[model samples]
Target: MPLYFYSTREPYGEFSNFALYGVKIDGEWWPTTEHYFQAQKFEDAAYRRKIRDAHSPKLAADLGRSRRVPLRPNWESVKDDVMRACVLKKFETHSDLRELLLSTGDEEIVENAPGDYYWGIGKDGSGKNMLGKILEEVRAKLKNAAC
Candidate 1:
């Protein structure tokens, strides 16, 4: 699956257009300033916007503020720098993501997409990661086969 980074408002109730870092499908970086995307940097925003917009047909709610690491330390509103969310199609190919964007818009795409993140945690806190467990199991199986 291709990982994409999208820029939305840093925090909810903030300016729409702001210069912030984002990620692209091809491991590219995207930055935005206020409501518009930083063109001099990477103008794929137009393409993304178009794709996201096209998904409005099955959309349930209006576009909401995008999410990213917390900038401010608002104890009431913002608690942690990393927000943990669960993307309930955790596995989808690049074409799947594109289809989702075009068919359901950004909101719906995100809604149906599967993902999650963790806040502040230490070494001991580093529990089982999905990919990590898979790799470990594969390694063990290979060792057993060799034996």
Candidate 2:
């Protein structure tokens, strides 16, 4: 049984603080978090691009008439944003940033991510990957750590 932190809110709600989890992929406990980071990086870039051009001129003027407002990426949004931006160099489990930190408790894992979001493994995740196609972005982020 894999142990991890789980958010208590429902999907689209606030993130959970901590929890425990399990999986059945290839009889493996979890997916991984390597490529997940890359995925997150790309996601953020894409998100910025979206909002940058999405604002209406009227609303933009009302908000700020003479100044540019570069809104910072929200922590929650960045988690998935960074994952989408990274191109796949390699795919592996142990390489996952989340897995490495969770399994080994290494601080270096946080630095490995593109932007530096340090949220670690969850106990009840479905092993989603960064592609956002998968449920675990961190799992896919550790491209080099998997064996």
Candidate 3:
């Protein structure tokens, strides 16, 4: 199975990147982003403010308020919706990703996160593997969408 990076909102183990980072995903893996800011039009008020603050002048007189203020930290609840959108978008655009998923037989695909024993197979390969289940559900949705 091919391994790819799937960004996480928070770091896991030694794999940490605050500015921007990617998580490792196998062939059964899916990638999604949680950057509530970047996922917007640049010209939008909040996005523009983020850009402006990041590129602000050093002078106090030139300092402008940034609209990059954090929103409610409810990613845990919102992530499923985000993931669904990502799966649909990827299936629509990335032919390789779509082919990888479509190539699967009736067998349930498992994407094991290396460090997550509850959500992935543990070091001994025994766990709930919820992410894998989510992938399966997303795949089914995609298949139904195509029909």
Best by lDDT: 3
- The global Cα lDDT (0 to 1) of model 2 is 0.29
User: lDDT tens digits, residues 63-100, model 2?
Assistant: 32222443345635664544333222222321342443
Q: Model 2 Cα RMSD, Å?
A: 15.6
Worst 10 residues of 3 by lDDT: 11-20
Candidate closest to the true structure, highest TM-score: 3
Candidate 1 worst ten-residue window by lDDT: 81-90
lDDT of 1 by residue, 22-62 (tens): 22423432232211121212234554453234333112012
In candidate 1 the C-alpha lDDT for residue 85 amounts to 10
- How far is each candidate from the true structure, as Cα RMSD in Å? 17.4, 15.6, 11.1
What is the TM-score ranking, best to worst?
3, 2, 1
> What TM-score does candidate 3 reach?
0.47
What does the lDDT read for residue 39 in candidate 1? 23
Worst 10-residue lDDT window, candidate 2: 12-21
